[model samples]
Target: MSLTHSVNMNWKLLIGVLAGLLIIGMFSGSSGQQSSSAGQQSQSRALEASNSVEWKKVDFLELELPANIQELRDQVKITSGKAKFFDQEIFYQTGAVPAGVSRSGRTVLLLHGAAFTSQTWIDKVPTLRTLAALGHGVIAIDLPGYGKSSQASVPDNGEFLARLIQSLAGKQPIVVSPSMSGSFIIPMLANPQYRDLISGWVPVAPVSTGLVASFSSQLLTPTLIVVGENDRSLGNRSKEDLKGLPNATLPQVLPGAGHPAYLDQPEMWHKLLHNFIIKVNQANSAQFMEA
Candidate 1:
């Protein structure tokens, strides 16, 4: 084989070895015996191998959320470090934010998008924790089969989601979702039990477009639609889909951004979400909650 071919083969083999070690370390830690130092070392080696890989795309479209054990406990109800909602398996990695104690006490229910696991937040631990510390009561959940919430059910998207919200949402919650999750979110906004319980909605890169059926036809809750520049073509057409709802607002476009702006562009997302929550709280604080 050519020298270059030999080098490539060697690199692939190294990566595979490192990956296997990481997985082994991960499972060993599952017994609550993996030392923090070992986990950090493994993570560092993993990032090094990943960075050495060839460039595939600079404009990645996925947004990653947080993936830490402490965060998991703070936001989720885990058993065997897993949660099953519906028929799908999910790895329940939770966030650090407690349910907020603001007089308004607004809770944020985070929903994952298509084909993504909560592993998205594997690199976003700091930012997520910061938001949690800010008293946002952010509950970022990995849908069924995603994150540590794996080994669960994957029932009908909308109904299963409603149950998840009811179980997780401690009070009047503000749903922050993306892509196809909006189908489930919009319906929850109209369900009587949840309708009176929903305070605000912030949909990022939602797939609520298309002529498909939806509960958008039923909601009257106030919302903020956050869109990334050069986002999905369907999301690009969201203006048409979100049109004419009484409490619906226009999209807040993120510059130099595309889909998954919340995770892909953490600083911007953090700022926008923080400000948006503060605004919603001011407008509907405990004295005048309309929901």
Candidate 2:
């Protein structure tokens, strides 16, 4: 063969080899993109399944007004209900649907301090009636051993509360936990599964131990931390510890209030709760529209 023809044939072979490599690279890139898309879809489906788990309802006794609750009986009606969780009965109180306030699909789950029962919400803040009047569903529960709920050896109260929230609200409900109940809730925010099921949090003078520091950055839910002006230590700690939360509000310290600030300043607490609920709901609505 002529030298020039031989060199031309070599060049054609080199072009063909380069073309083959280009095709292989394109195919690999396409497969990688498909795999990434599949991964995202799987994650979305798993989250939806986690959020959609159904809870069974259990029988509950009628609430007989104790002397502590008798004074507010006429102003707001209360009903008792129970749900079974792992052979334990979880009792809860539901405030009556206030006249002219339509069910807004925005539910609030009230968890009280260690010393208080579900009645404390109504007795102290009248939160249930106030929330109901604002067109929200209100459920105040007696944590495992408190009030009428049966106690069990709960290994993880955070997981237990997450399940209780799922069962009670049938969707992501706004959680309002005061004092010791924060011990259970703040940790729950670390678990993505539990975190996905909650819409928002209102932690009032919560007992923040070491857990707050580790999981503060992992919090994805909208949070509001409220403390009393008198409870400076906890108020300052919460403000500093929870600064990592992406969607947290500036800590609100009620004027002239003590540890149980809600009891002393019910009106301010109610206003803040109402406003937070509205803000969260609006954000959720905007997200839904964007999606």
Candidate 3:
């Protein structure tokens, strides 16, 4: 071959190799940029979840709960306290958020039925410990004239509850009101001033549900009305009355359970409570972001 022809051929090969490398570099740079952008978006979402990047990594639904009640009770550390409101000292048992877990930025208040007290929640069910283990502050309270609390009755149930909730759970607490506590909760639900203080409500066959049943359309607080399938009277009645609330969900019926449903179906009850609390916090976080 002629030298000139050979030189021309080598030049063509060099040009071809250079063109290929340039194309590869363009694609590599684009791919790298896309990866970086995706990472940034993920981080932004983490930050939006209550200012805690750790929350994005943790899924409350996947967290483990102890199968043994005694072991769980032992594993969780709880304390007792009394909050004075309106000349009445309310007795309560509280559990703090567990270690190494990001706080959900929410609290849970457990109120008992007439037959039960604050200890009933700890001994009969896994409400308090499960909530604490899942990174939420939890409190089980003995209403006035019950358990360790003073025998003096509350003059204004709604006002007393409002004070107690603010003093104990802070703003936006998820309240678990079972049986007779419904009288206190229903009144609070009807009052517009206390609406923002409570994040969510679990009315477990509470009494005096009829008071708000007619005006439930105006009550916008997120409510989860739960009852037992076997509890034909109060359970069904409470659901019927409170289900009309604007933001209320359908009655969550626990199968084969009775009036104090959580005692008979603790696992299912805890699962529902966990899911509701997480959803409430998520909604609040979203609202905060939008605002």
Candidate 4:
């Protein structure tokens, strides 16, 4: 072979190698662009899901409830007692339906905030009697370290709460948790087994909501997120974080109220609570009928 022929062969080989490298780079760039586009689309869908479900809009006006627990007590029968709860005496108030009225078989477990106790449901707002009047059994318990209930020696809030509910609340009670009690309720809610035990959840400007934010989409025990419009931090942040839940409703915000909004507007707050209870019962009934 001549030198000229050898040089021509080398040039042909070099051209082929360059063309192959160029083709590979093109495919790599296209793949990177496709991956980036897929990521953006996923993020966009998540954002849409977060924003699509609007909050349940109810007209709320901040008003002082008539200061008369006696009036409410006279209307419904309320009994106070303490039950033994695993080394702690758990004090509670039971507002039974008026003697003749048929029972709805629904029990509501009322848990208080850091600043309040079981009596806050009875004295401050007549919450127990008001709910009882609706034909549902309402029990307001003084959590350990607050009110009449003995302080818990155990460190696990979730275990303590689960045991209390199982021992006290008869079969899938609707739990009403407010403020600091979120520390207890949020942990309980994170467990799927415990979630099965609760029929419904009402979290009122609950703290520690961030703990569940990452997996809240799976925490689907029909939840009603209640908050005050004036509560700018925990309330709003929780609303945003929890709104992504598949079965959660948009938050119920009380106008001109702050943290622990129920105290600020008891009448409106009670009305909302009653409505939520009714909704939960109806849903349960429907499921039973379907089954």
Candidate 5:
């Protein structure tokens, strides 16, 4: 063959190789783009699911009207009810539901300190009415021997609380307890089965039981610890005890308050409870979506 003919043949072979390379590159680029688009779509769906189904807004107007603090205090309709626990009759005071509002799945159990009755919640601060206005079912109970309830010497307060929680709320409900009531709640936290029954916990200046340090590392329940700035002994101890809770919020110190800070700073107390409940609900929704 002549030299020019051989050179032309070589050139043709080089062009063919280049063309194959270009086609491969184009296909790979297209595949990459498609994969990236699919990833973006998946992320968008996750976000939408998290946001769309998360927290729900309450229809305040449809519920009973506690327009002002005074009306909330005076308008509280008290009812007597009995629960049979271990063959013992336990009496409790439950706030009456309004004409149109549904009570199902909206209850918030309030446990007061040893010093006060369930009425302390209604009389001192407008917490019940405020929560009611926000569309929560409020049940402030007087532990046996307090308020209008019958007296009983309970062997295990924790077991009693667990039973109460199951009977009062169809599902897990937000529990708000202050001072001595913390002792009742601490045992539940230590028990895995009982702890899961509670959705969230708000403990205010709870008396320390020395058990918090043992279970704090294992606690999974969402908690908000509120303490009075002035009640150094109990408040500081509570904060230290909660240090091991992985999902717990930093201690919230109420300003210009003492042991019973909720009464001293009613507005701040109400705001904290409202926001914490919303946060817990949102987290629950996100977990449900992931599942």
Candidate 6:
């Protein structure tokens, strides 16, 4: 390798090491300090996720990715601090649709996968927003330190999300969690405490490879498991997670897509969501009418 290239790689590696140290140190604070000092943490976090412009600070776009996917992903260099949902106050616009636009028919809780912030839905938002205009609420949330809410270290991710869901949903919400977030949803629903708070669940390409047991008969209630053809084991695992519940729907696998279809194919994701919302609302209305 050229001397210049080697030097660049070194700088990026150094930045990544520093970021790792800070992440560990910040989370290692005493309980009080962690809580108090956390409220005052700076919004900027520059973790070097890839080997680009090594001498510079860590940017969001430099992560390890395939060239095609990299070309598809266009995010900002700056990473902002977003709070965990239930940890603090996060205000959603009236009508529970989304941050932008109006006139949505149903509330959609968009739960993102791990290692990604809520902004991963940026490309998917436009398509979702269209449905919002036609009457479907879509919300993409950041898990603790992921997006532009408030920042906190993610220790108990499941509990954190449970609390976060309570705060964000306020009332019962129709949740749609993709990949790892899908696993979070299962635990959230199985808990009687949260089961009542969730109107329905939609797991997209879940990452519950080892959590198949959670899908026992009691957990199903208007659940939809979506997957992609290219997703190898997640589909089967997702099936297992919601196993005994007849109320849970089978996997709605997308064509020509992989594990991350929500981001990889926003249009397809939107269509699937649109159809699901309509069906859910329709069924809910019928039950009410019958009553």
Among residues 3 or more apart in sequence or in different chains, the pairs in candidate 4 whose N, CA or C atoms overlap within 3 Å are 55-250
Candidate lDDT scores, in order, read 0.57, 0.72, 0.78, 0.77, 0.71, 0.54
- Residues 1-291 of candidate 2: C-alpha lDDT, one tens digit per residue: 999999999999999999999999999999988865763554354333322311011111112212433243345567888887766888899987655546678889999888898989777668887776666888999888788874644668888888888788758789988888877787677665567677778888787645766765555566777889897776667666765565667677788988888888887787778667766676667556546
Ranking by lDDT: 3, 4, 2, 5, 1, 6
TM-score of each: 0.61, 0.73, 0.75, 0.74, 0.71, 0.60
Candidate 1: residue 95 Cα off by (Å): 3.4
TM-score ranking from best to worst?
3, 4, 2, 5, 1, 6
Return whichever of 3 and 4 wins on TM-score.
Answer: 3
Candidate with maximal lDDT: 3
Instruction: Extract clashing residue pairs from model 5.
Output: none
Instruction: Please provide, for model 6 over 1-291, each residue's C-alpha lDDT reduced to its tens digit, 9 standing for 90 to 100.
Output: 999999999999999999999998877766667655442231111011111122112121222222332222222121223333444533222222333333434666666777655555554454334444444555567655445444555556667667766665545567878776765666665554445455567777676535545445344346666777777777656656553444555566677777776655665666566555555565555544544
What's the distance in Å from true for residue 188, model 4?
0.7
Residues 1-291 of candidate 5: C-alpha lDDT, one tens digit per residue: 999999999999999999999999999999988875763554343334334332223221232333564454455565657777666666666666544544334567888898987778777877776676555677777776666664664678789888988997547788888888887788876775576666778888787646887766556666777889898887888877874565667778898899888999887788777676666666667767676
Instruction: Name the lDDT of candidate 3.
Output: 0.78
lDDT for 276 in candidate 3 is: 70
In TM-score terms, candidate 2 sits at 0.73
The residue-level lDDT of candidate 5 at 88 comes to 60
**C-alpha lDDT (0 to 100) for residue 129 of candidate 2:** 75
- Those runs of model 5 whose alpha carbons end farther than 4 Å from true positions after fitting are 1-78, 96-105
